[model samples]
Target: MRRALAIFFVFISFQVSGQGVLDWWDQLHNYPDAAGPDRSRYINLSPGYLGPNAMIMPSLPNMTIDNEFWVQALGQTHAGNGDKTQNFFLKGNFPLARDRVMLYITSVPYETWEVTPETRDERRMMGLGGKGGNTGDVAYGVIFKVFREKHWLPFNFGFRLHTKTTTGGNLTNARSTDNSLYQWEGNFSKTMIEKEEEKLLLKASLGFVTWQTNKNRLPGGSNHNQNDAPYYGFGVEYLNRSWLLSSDVVGYTGYLGNRDYPHFFRTQVQYRFNRLALRTEYNYGLQSWDWNTFSLGVRYYILELLD
Candidate 1:
């Protein structure tokens, strides 16, 4: 799997050449405290396969729909046990009475392969078994630009509230969608460097997530009692006309006394074109749940529904 991923990365790197069309990082306000003068043109970054973007798992304050609708498709391969997941996301944003207040909705449909030892052995023997598909939980949220950058402060502050529904398939054990979960997050970002065709930004966010476990049953009749945990993340983004690179570290302590805090690092590279983008990402789990993931995604701005 690692060799296949490495080869895939190399192939994509060579297939796309020249400078990127759009500053993929520029669209994210979470990197800098100040939205700057051109904030209106920036769109929110795609949440990737992890759903929300916060530390171990929360959305960042840089969420913006910018009066546009988006559709994205992602193919992800988990390095462990040779599992694979594919996802399709549809989202859009609408402005409220004020520009700082926005409403948005996101939906995901996914398919996954459950690669267990037994399943692998069965595949080797009988050539069949482990695969399932389902529509994942949906999320509806609101974003508030609590405070835009001002002379008194160098950073921008934003808040987000999201409610995720329990409506998804659980045939494979890889789904994170709960019966229902509510999340609240606060984020800040600031631009650290700016040059003619290059820019750097820093972003941080903290959040809490709580959920009901009625639908998430455990094996052996043991109740799946997951404690709510606080999550936080920090990231840096560098953007140039042809290439964009981003890296972030997020961690959270589990509620269960026996579960230690886990940290994860994710890195992404994107080649942007006018109205179109292609990206590849890798995420490494540092502690607690240990796993490596590789993902490739394609995004199209499509068309401007509104100015």
Candidate 2:
């Protein structure tokens, strides 16, 4: 009876935060604005900044850590709006599961390229001391939400501890923003699905992320430091099914170590003929002093990039 109750609570927690509540914090580093679907077979494709909304599905054969399941290879590329430099990523995962216990191993070899005014104005910005960079990491973690289908709002949160355990320019342990720290985030979704689709859908989430407090800042920037901060946001996605368009903004205003205020935004859209999900967003900088960024991403279900 006690075991059944524990399993039951696990289901309820999954429905609430979308995963293990504490695990969601990791998504903030990937893409902060894209609120993802709380379901199986989901993956967010945004490059460097993965928002809490772009989390992966927990129960796939390819996502387990042990030999319980197999792993698949996937690749992606992205171009930034400012710099002509491009970002690239390649990854695979192995799934592990047994009855109510589940775990996953994800390996991502990724690189980020950057160029800013500082690079352009080497003589003026720093008297010939400007520099650009490339950084990547291999992240592995365990994910186990629920063993069954959900009826109420479902939570799909998780944790994937990334060790700069590979080769990269910023692989030094002393680098504040490049090293490592524990990241966490959680999201809950309630569906008002009609037999033929619906009108109202709501998603609420809470997350706490502690970033390296680096004194060095981004180009034309600030918000550099080792901050063990936390933040939260809520969103509402209304689906008409016919058009299949969704518009939602998820943000947090400095909660217990919250770095910035009103952090991320995701203007959402879904396309038919191919079941494509899309997002265009604006990232805000709080008091920390970082350059604001504009981002856009498309969802390709055939490729399983559920962004």
Candidate 3:
């Protein structure tokens, strides 16, 4: 594990070096705003605990992506179960009618899951004992932003509809492949504090997630009791020119009852250098079945390539 991490770091260093060269060229040419797009608009789009930026249980507004493709590579470690997961994400934004309506797509190329001894034992009890290292399912989704940011009374509101497809590896036993789901969210964000290059923002979101279950494919033929759940999240972010620090306490109540709800706390820090970003985050699950996770990742925003 240590060796693999070392190698990954080496690769990141090389990528950063290449990005630095591009940065120098952009500076020399005085590239238009398209080349060095405004970072403030996307600062809150960083990935959250479960691999997407929806806070703990739901996604909320941060910044809007205009015309860009964003790529992310994240390495995650789950402590309680001694598991490791790696994720690669690709996202693109296309203007349907500029800010009024936009189409966005996000997809996970693939994820790798490494099971620990403890997990193996648990699986063995369920007749699934085997070595770890399995490729996870590929998931892709599309987001339709219904409206641009609008001031409604004291808050700015944005609405979106998103749907995810379950396409990839094993979707049954290991659960690395999840069920398909649809979500509709209303997001609100407000600037609470502002200074020269420093600002603090508050964000909140409410949504409903309806899940599609495949009970026949599950191990032991157990019926998935998942019901439509209400998702809620609250987050705060402090941003400076080159630094971003944020924390969120978010969760959802199960449709069944209070006992079935899941909650989590997440924190993240990011450093930006031109168009390259380095980030790290930690998440603590507040529920019985949830696992605590830590992740390190990097993001590169390509504004001119697709434009």
Candidate 4:
């Protein structure tokens, strides 16, 4: 069994998911007194993001869609043990409501098996069939400018609602399988002040989710977790030609769910050249379950292929 587990981990590379997500941490770190997001700072208006970027970004005016694929390898093993794991996530995002709303649908199906080695008899082990999960999530929101202060302080606000796994996933304990948390989440973020190089922010959100088992769809056979989470953000930007770098985070608060509190920290760099733009970010998490991560992504202007 140990031999088999070793082979399985080798077959799946573990370094694919270099960048993870810590949502809304950047906003709360700055503008520590606002509570809304505007226009393009979120998924509703932007193309694709694994983690929150910064408070300064907003959505584009036109509707757009982005296809994102992650090739990740996950497994766990200890000396003289046969425990193993593997998983993957792929999704596409598109905007609606004239680019003010957004939807995301994806699937993650994987196979895993584990074993416990023994000293006396031959090793006895446990293994699950290659059963995984399929998940679908949708969100919608709108943003607008609240006030335009001259030269020093400007305010922006946004409202967003999210529905989780309104569609798919099977029951298993192998990979990225969401058992349909038919829950709703509402969030708001705000920027209270901003200038050419400094900024401040505030944000809040509430979530309610009911997760019923597939075998029993009734009330008692389900689990629900709901909470109100809030945080604040502060940041500064240093401009170098067409490139900019920003850092921000919120401290001392969180959703207090399975993850940890005061969850925050995200830094991003954005560069523009003609009609092309590129972005890269490194995010730090206060949660114990995750490690610091980063990613690089790009956008291109294919006007030659446009209508």
Candidate 3: misplaced stretches above 4 Å?
Answer: 1-59, 63-68, 81-108, 114-128, 137-152, 214-226, 257-260, 304-307
CA displacement after TM-score superposition, residue 140 of candidate 4 (Å): 5.7
Candidate 2 Cα errors over 4 Å, as ranges: 1-133, 137-168, 171-176, 212-226, 240-262, 274-307
Off by over 4 Å in 1: 1-69, 81-99, 102-104, 118-131, 171-178, 214-226, 258-262, 303-307
Q: In terms of TM-score, how similar is model 4 to the real structure?
A: 0.41
Best by lDDT: 1
Residue-level error in angstroms, candidate 3, position 243? 1.0
TM-score of predicted structure 1: 0.64
lDDT of each: 0.55, 0.36, 0.54, 0.32
TM-score-based ranking, best first? 3, 1, 2, 4
lDDT of 4 by residue, 1-307 (tens): 9999998876664433221121223232222222123211111111010111111111211111122221212121111112232223233344333323444443333323332332101110011222222332322233322223332333223333333443322222211123232323333434555567554444443444333222221211112232233433455444465675667653322233322233446676778676565766665655421234454655443332111
> Tens digit of lDDT per residue, candidate 2, span 1-307?
9999999999897787654442433243222232223211012111122211112111112111123333333333332322333233333333444432344444334433444543223211111222334444444544443422252324323333322233333322111133344445544445555456655655554555443432323222234444444545566666565445443444333322322333444444444344444544343333322234444455333322111
Give the deviation of candidate 3 from the true structure as CA RMSD.
Answer: 18.6
Q: In candidate 3, what are the lDDT values of residues 201-286, reduced to their tens digit? A: 88887877665332332222213534477877899989999999989877666544423356788898989898889988888877
**TM per candidate:** 0.64, 0.44, 0.65, 0.41
Q: Who is ahead in lDDT, 3 or 4? A: 3
In model 1, the worst 10-residue window by lDDT is 40-49
Question: Candidate 3, which ten residues in sequence have the lowest lDDT sum?
Answer: 40-49
For every model shown, the clashing-pair count is 11, 41, 2, 24
